[model samples]
Every structure is written in C-alpha cells, then in structure tokens.
Target: MELRCKVFLRYCTCFAVIGALLVWPAPVHSAVVVIGARPYLERVAKRVVEILEGRYISGNSLPIADYVAPIQLTDKGLSITGNVSFHSAFLAKIDSIEFDAQKFSEIFLNTEVTVQGALKWHGIGVVLDFAANLEEYNGTGTLYVTYNQFDFPLKVTKPFNSTEPTGSLQFMSIDNSNKIVTVGYPNNKYVQLISRAIMTNFDFRDYMIASFRNWNFQNLLKAVIDEVPFPEVCYNC
Candidate 1:
C-alpha cells in the first residue's frame, strides 16, 4: 500500500506539471509597425528585384523601401501585414540593335495567402514563387521571403509559347521606354505586357505580382507587428 501510494503521488505530481504547461496561455500576440525599412522584407524585395532585373540587385537595401507589417499571432489565425512596391522592375539588357531601350520590368499579382504553424520565435523567411514576364521575355522564378532569419525559397516558372522574335506590350512608365511604347494597352499597362508574354490560358506574372504587392511577407509581418496588441511581447510563445 505504501509503495502504491508513493507511485500515485509521483504520477499526480507529473500530471500537475503537465496541466500547468497545457493551460498556460500562448505567450501573447506581439506585433509592430515600422515606419522605416525592415531588414527581412527588404531582403525579400531585393531578391525579387534581382530576379526581375535578371541580375542580383545591388546594395543591401533597396533605394526606396516601404515597411508594412509584422507577424501576428491570434486565436483565429496567424495574420501578417505589409506591402513593398518599386517604382520600376527593370533589368538592364542592351543589344547592338536599332532601338536603345532600357529593360524595365514590373509584376502584378492577386494573392490570398494565410498560413498557420508554430514559429521558432528566432527568425525565418520564406519566398513565394511566381511566373514572370519582362516585356517580351517570359520566365518563372522564386520570390525569396524570410521570417525570424529563416529564408523561404519559392520559384515559379512561366511556360511561354515559342513566340515570334518580336512582340510588343505596354509596360509601366517607370522609365522612358515604356512611355514611348504605349499602344493598344490600358493606361495601367500591366495587362498588356503580361498578356503578350505568357501566351497561355492563365496569367502567372500578373497573379504573382498582385500577391507580392499586397502581402510580400515582410510587409505583412510588419503590419502584423504593428497591429499586435502589445509591443514588448505580451505572450511571446
């Protein structure tokens, strides 16, 4: 009886400890909004820019950077915020040909992304993938976004038809060439460029661009951080 009682007492103690851990509230939701540029999102955007440019973008931070949101922890779901947009998504490609045009690229996407998982709390980044079309050139690549120091690798390819050597589509007027080549395209010419390049039933570049514009992880995270009910990590689980 004595031995049985001891074993029972130990079992009860273990259960009590387990109960404390289970009932413990998930630390708390912490979010912050930064007016200045954020490093993680910047890295993601920079990678996107590099992919667009056909070469790695120079500098650690984009010349123009906007911060949106931070990661959010909530009972309902994990929500993140922020958006980073560039004036031009152009790559410099020169040919010894008749026209002297600076290669500029832009992306548009319609993205609805919501994910739920246990975060390491340190840092991790995940880059989404999307199809791409730069003027007449079409391809697929990844958008590398990160969180808490982890890098997310996303590569989306665009399978384009074997188009003629020459094709024309309107481009964003981030540079002078786009202004000159505006015809048969809407004033907001993301449509024209994407339409001509993909040459398929579905448009991946535009879709991805829309997704990146609204929730490029960094911006979403920034927004979440900003909207978080607390600053110093109330429940930093």
Candidate 2:
C-alpha cells in the first residue's frame, strides 16, 4: 500500500508539471536584427528619391508660402530701406538625386532642385527722415539650388505597449555653402543691387531645409521595403 501511495504521488506531481508547461504562454520573439542592412538602405533611399522625383514631375511639387522681408542698410552715409516679397513660389523640379549610405541608419543625399517664382522689391532712399521710392523691381525667374551631402538620419522607436516599430527620417547638418542658389537675370546695376540685397536678407538654405524637414520619407521607404523579404537575424530572443 505504501509503495502504491508513493507511486501515485509521483504521478500526480508529473501531471501537474506537464499541465503547467502546456498552459503557460510561450516567450514572444520581438526583436530582429537586419543583416547587411546597407544595401537595403541604399535601395530604400533610391526608391524614396524616385518617388519624390515622380511626384514633383506629376504636378505635386511642394508649395512655398509667400515670403516678405524688410531690408535696411547704411553705407557711406546713404541709407537704404526696402521690402522684398517672393510669391507664387513652387519647388518645381528635382533635376537629379544621389544617395550615399554611410551606415545602416544614416544616409547622405545630394540633389539639385529648381524653384520657380516671382519676386517684387520696393526700396526707399531715406535721407534725414525723408523717404522716397528709389527703385521698384519686379521679376519672374527660376532658382537652381543644389544641396550637397545633406545627412538623413533614421530614427526607430517602439512604444512601450506595442510590438511594431516605427521609424522616421530626420534631416540634419547641411553646410550653408552646400546650399547653393543660382539665378540668371539680366546684368544691370539695378538688378545686381536688388539681387545682392535679396540674397543678403533672404535665407534660401533655411527655406529649403524647412521644406524638407516637413516631408516624411520613411513612410514612402517602408511601403517599398515591407514587400521585400530581406534576410534578418533574431535579436534579444
């Protein structure tokens, strides 16, 4: 009887352990590390550039708000005050784009873009509180701007309660010289003066950076990459 009771107790303990093993939830494998991620990132960058170029060509160009700046300067006892306004501005075309993948989460982009718009400048010569309209210039033209080697850093975040990861592309660290803006206008003293004044007062680089910062390229990239079956390794399992 004693032997039978001991055998029965051991069987019950085994059944309890088996039941616990069967009922407990399995560990969730939530982390994955991408292998050879550079090529994939390069592809994603190309696709994003293509999409942006296509969109710009298809009449979905980015619209710029009307910009107005007040210009004031004094040289050789000559006071000049003016107001410059740029209107109907649009980032009309993307001529070319080049991508360099520096790392799995960082990319550098070089692009040439064209901005078409109209500008008006009204200047007054102020002498001893007496102001008179000296020059009023109005013109329409295109600005060819080149951005060289601008950094796009990828940021990934996972919510505390969510398993899916979210990503974003951030624009960062563009050299002022790299943001080159050139326009062709008739070579005249008045035009030259206006151009110099406008260029001095208006920051084209900041405007371009602001426009790019507003765009979310990660969504476009994810749309293409999600369909691809890239090799990955398990992480934090």
Candidate 3:
C-alpha cells in the first residue's frame, strides 16, 4: 500500500506540472521599424539603381556613368534621383548621324522619381510582384531627360503603357510604422509626357520616353522587400 501511494503521488505531481506548462503565456516579440529598416532599404535602392543603369545606359546605349543619387524614404514610399550622361563618343555618333536636321550629341538626363503604394502578401498564390488596383497607387515622377544638359522637367502621370512609353501607371508605398510595403500596377496606362520641349521640336523625346519605360520600379520594390529580414509570422506586417 505504501509503494502504491508513492507511485500515485508521483503521477499527480507530473500532471500538475504538465498542466502549468500548458497554461503558460508565450513570449511576444515586438515589430522593429524605422531604425533597423532604413539602411537596409537604402542598400536595396542602390542595387535597383544599378540594375536600371545597366538597362538604360550600358552597352550600345551610353558609355557615361549612370548616377543614382541617394534616396529618401517617405510615408507612402520613397523618392530618388539619377544622373544619366551621354559620353563624348556617344555624342560624336549622334553628331555623325542627322536625325532631325540637327547635330545631336552630348546630353545629360537628370530624372526624379516618386514611388508610393503598399506591399501586401496575397497568401501563397503567385507571391512575387502581385498586382493591387491601379487606383491604390500614387507612383509618379518628373523627367529631365534632355539634350546638351538641358533641364526640361516633364511631369509624368500614371497609367504607363508599353505603347506610349512616356508616363507610368504604377503605385507603391513603404510603411515602416506598419512594417509593410505594397505595389500596384495598371493593366493599361497612358504615361503622358507633358513637355514644352515636345512642342518645340525636341527630336529626342521619343528616346527619352523609351528610356523612361525601361525604369522598372517594381523590381526596385522587390529588391527592397527581399533585403529586409521580416519575421515569419509578420504579425505587425
């Protein structure tokens, strides 16, 4: 009877310990924002700039250095600038060929971009670069893509299309407070390049417009998201 009582007591103690363990609250980890995120986003932004440089200014395009200046993070997204220069060799080529009854050679393209929207994960269905409504985006920018280093700032409106190749119809936002980012693209958009130079017979408008089309903002946003180490649960995101 004594042995049986001791065994029964041990079983009771084990049950009590197990019950306590089950009822214990799990530890919570707070979401990290602005402080730990900015530098990472900046690095991503620089990489994006490099990719754009490769697409627009490399190889047979231009031998000059494509400069992507520093970026500024905003409430909805971020803003960035780049210096696109045409080297003397490119200029000489342009001078050699007569495009529109003019000697077209040395040029500088200074562009400003403002990207706004949010990043959302729509479960496991096609996780990369999902599309939100066009109305949800506020992505837009100005183009100083011109000749002889002329600063012709053209307002770029939304609804970017491959046909028009002037304005873009994409919206993206970066919310560090909520620890979330998003991108929205229109199925079809007329990216209007409203410029006085176009009316003044700027023969390079088409080339400038084409270059604008090559700047893929979506890739940039993707790079930024990929760089950050978000928690698996993403309770805050």
Using all chains and alpha carbons, the TM-scores for the candidates as numbered come to 0.16, 0.54, 0.24
| Clashes per candidate (backbone, < 3 Å) | 51, 0, 16
Q: Tens digits of per-residue lDDT for model 2 on 130-177?
A: 112334445443333333345556433333334444445555555355
Best by lDDT: 2
Pairwise TM-score winner, candidates 2 and 3: 2
The residue-by-residue lDDT of candidate 1 on 1-237, one tens digit each, is 999999999999999999999998866566322222123223433443334344222332222222221111222342222221222222222211111112222222332111111111122122333343233333434333222211122221111221111111111211121122212222233334322232221232243233333323344333333332211211123
Better of 1 and 3 by TM-score: 3
Q: Assess candidate 2 and give its TM-score to the true structure.
A: 0.54
Off by over 4 Å in 2: 1-33, 73-80, 103-150, 155-165, 184-187, 197-199, 202-208, 229-231
Put the candidates in TM-score order, highest first.
2, 3, 1
Score candidate 3 by TM-score against the native: 0.24
Indicate the worst ten consecutive residues by lDDT in candidate 3: 91-100
- Whichever of 2 and 3 has more lDDT, that candidate is 2
